[model samples]
Target chain A: MRHLVITIGCEYGAKGNAIGRKIAEDLNIKFYNRDLVDEIIEEVGIPKEIMEKVEEGGTIAGKGAEGDVRGSFSKYADLTDRAIHVQKQIIRKLAEKESCVIIGRSADYILKDTKDIDLLRAFIYAPDEVRIHNIMESHNLSEKDAKILLLEKDKRYHKRHLALTGSNRGDRHNRDILMNSSYLGIEGTAEYLEELIRRKFGSEEE
Target chain B: MRHLVITIGCEYGAKGNAIGRKIAEDLNIKFYNRDLVDEIIEEVGIPKEIMEKVEEGGTIAGKGAEGDVRGSFSKYADLTDRAIHVQKQIIRKLAEKESCVIIGRSADYILKDTKDIDLLRAFIYAPDEVRIHNIMESHNLSEKDAKILLLEKDKRYHKRHLALTGSNRGDRHNRDILMNSSYLGIEGTAEYLEELIRRKFGSEEE
Candidate 1:
């Protein structure tokens, strides 16, 4: 079988990582999510959460709060610029290395022009109510708090995508599929996608 | 089997009607497309193309173009207001009566709150290159004209959808499934969806 790469972009609390991880496990392929981001974050000298904000072009509040606002903003720019470069290289390398499921970080856009690998780009999302409920249960937060948190992170997700790939995160053009998890739940969604990928780009062997 | 309503919203050249019609045929259900719109257009007393413009809140270019612009605009508003009411009523009545696949005219949104029918909402789209290619061959236009026509109609599709649904047509929340036809091609896409719908909401019989 040809090398296949599935890149997933999703809404906050949609369990995108959970879905990707499941597909990867079922297919017995490498799954890249935080480990990929953390590697880039290590280079940027910031935590994963902080990287989302910095990558969205937001200034780090600590050093810039009192003085040298421009300096701090550019400092972020430098970090993000470096991270973006490292991101593409790493994404391409990973896809070349093996068939894998990649979650976010614009893997679809980065690999858009690559000729050899089989690519399945998908976006997973759900209605706000389903997402809010997932967030509340998973994070041990109230419904109201989950709503607030969901909105905050969802914005940065789009901003971060736009920063890296010039295309809107939710744009249909970016994905081969966009699925809502409300009806099927995570396991079902993962199973459905696995079947789809196998049929679309499955191996010759059993 | 319970009555199932699959409402599909799609880009112009995605062959969504073909996909929906195939699913309905396979499932042995009613397929709705231009027939539903033609019914309303007869009442609107305008061509289908003109209705696309008018429903997007653009005034008719005739009957009051010179003397009474407001009159023409309000007349359209009245016609659209009437159309909107009829559109929803007809959509609900058809869905309530039988299992069907309804294409475009914001059928998904119109059926959003309907309680009785089992609804599967999908949005079909493809990359611009693929869509442009499809439109060129199907519409007998040059590549350049097809490109221009594609953009023009795509914008009006979204606008007409928003005017009726109060939600962006591409919003993931509005759909249970969004499939891109570029990868699978129309027949494969229809087959995939038929399998998916059957697995998810299939009848008790074989």
Candidate 2:
């Protein structure tokens, strides 16, 4: 089967992963997110804990632990870089092998040159009120705590995007569509994306 | 009283003039077009023959028989430029005194700096098929003749826009809204414009 890559991008609690999963289910395609984490760990030989920390955007040893001059500092840095490199290779490999939906890791920029790839890049966003409510319900946190966590996660994602792509977090211009999830709610948004994908590829499939 | 500049832009046979007249009536404003020729004869002190020669883009005199050498040797070369400049000043003066809708003098760009001006720039367009039908009904022309006339008019308008504004004719990034008059028809488009103007300024007038 030919491959189609769908990238779901958003800040935390904006339902990027959930949307990607729904699209994959509707299309009957494999979806990859944290599942790639294990493949990355095995390939890079990095410790699972370190991989998880980096994946969640925790600072590496030197940056986080103020002046911890350990002898194995270089080793930790190499492992982190290698793990990232392996994850990117796996993503490319999956795209080559079959149709799949990828949630983040800057998939849009990574596969910019590949042909016959229906690269549907979407930005999912919600107003602050709706986002805060979603976070509270999902995490079972107090309003204040949810707000704090949401803000921090947003910042971390923004920083991660900048670090990975050296550009703004969202590709507003390159994206085929920009969705305000508030307009459609979660399930509606997924259905909308499915329709868009079908419109783009339906004729080709026939 | 404030002057409202209404720019009637279209790709020939697009009913720009008709739409402009309707807008003027809806707001009890004076409309300008070929009727401006009579006004210019009175205001600019130019002879009626000279106005006619330049009415539909006559050339200035001495450029060639095809050109008008009087001003720039192109048909309507002398009159079109004079009309634009005179219309600009008249629009400014009229705006100072009362609200009015000035049509098809590139009024949007001309009145860019005027205060208390609610500039409504509109582009009216009809598909070729619709334009041909309208011309056939209004002018008693054959389909082929009407099509030729429409094409020529479109070209003239395009050249006029470039000459006046250094931009393609009816390219409406400058306009607030673009309406397909084919769908709205003449009266409906006018009513819609009236509703829009009322929505924008109704409460302020109150």
Candidate 3:
């Protein structure tokens, strides 16, 4: 059987990680989230703090140190780019090895050019109102704050992802399944995706 | 309270009609499918046969009369376009008065420009496998036939809709929700959309 890899890109507050984790559990395959990628990056000697900060919407501008920080800006940008490149390399290597579910880090685009493996790309998203409600409850945030945070984070992630992948997150052509998880619930969404993946490759499974 | 309308564009065999019917029933509003449009077209002096044939994919050419009937193609096309325009006018008038769920007929794009009405555009689609299964069971068709019919019908609808609306059905920006109802039974899908609509305009309801 060919190696089957599922790549899931999600909108912020869409419970994408929860859905991806559930799919991996149901399929009995490994799942890779950002934390897993962080571990891989740390193993290569990149500071965990720098990776975490980058993950949290890039390095903060040095406090009132504007003119003094132009050099650091370029340095931070290069480190972030390097981090993304290494993550993509890790994603490609993982897909070549076995069946797994990968969440984010543009795994879909990284594997877009692969020919030998079975790749299923999905993007999970939700309406803004539902997303805001989820974020507000999960983070103990007010509705206004939740809305602002979700938008800001999504913008940053989208720009970074576009820069790295040369593709948009929710482009339908690149996806086998583009769905709103807001209505499907986490388990329902995961189970449906499992069925789709199984149906796509089940004939070849031993 | 502001007027609200939900426009659903769906791939063939996606059970979009069932979902839309349920939503209208739950919300106590009218549901307009092709039949409703046909009635309006017939009232305008177009033959029911032409409208029905157009609805059934623009009239298949008679087996032996292909060349003999080539001249009628433009006539049929003109009638079909007229039917669609009248349907859009009806859709706009309906939105002007009350909240309702409309299925197909490019209602999403027809109502796309209304500023006073709260329009929620959704595209309901399923993976090819699940859709084929639905079509086979519902139409008592062979799998191969079902697949062909689905593909052909979806292509036709997509082309006609694009020409009428200047928008693609599943484009994310054109839709507030793009969901797969393949796993979420019709009821689950309807209930979720109901919640979304309620959250959007419920504050102004008396």
DockQ (Cα-based) for each candidate:
0.78, 0.03, 0.09
Which of the predicted structures, 1 or 2, would earn the higher lDDT when compared with the native? 1
lDDT of 1 by residue, A70-145 (tens): 8776786566676667777778888888888889888888888888888898889988999999999999999889
- How far in Å is the alpha carbon of B188 misplaced in model 1? 0.7
The whole-model lDDT of each prediction reads 0.79, 0.65, 0.74
**Which one wins by DockQ: 2 or 3?**
3
Chain A alone, TM-score per model: 0.84, 0.82, 0.82
- Please state the Cα-based DockQ of model 2 relative to the true two-chain complex: 0.03
Q: Which residues of candidate 3, in runs, are more than 4 Å off?
A: A48-81, A203-206, B1-105, B108-169, B173-206
Runs in model 1 lying further than 4 Å from the true structure:
A40-53, A58-76, A203-206, B40-53, B58-76, B203-206
Looking only at chain A, give the TM-score of model 1 against the true structure. Answer: 0.84
Candidate that scores best on TM-score: 1
Candidate 3 versus truth, CA RMSD in Å, comes to 11.7
**What DockQ does model 1 achieve?**
0.78
lDDT of 1 by residue, B21-86 (tens): 888888888888956666755564655655555566433334455567686667766766766676
Model 1 lDDT at residue A158: 79
Question: Against the correct fold, how does model 1 do in TM-score?
Answer: 0.88
**lDDT by residue for model 3 (B78-176), tens:** 666776667677778877878878888777777767888777788788767888999999999999999899988878876666656666656665565
Q: What pairs collide in candidate 3?
A: none
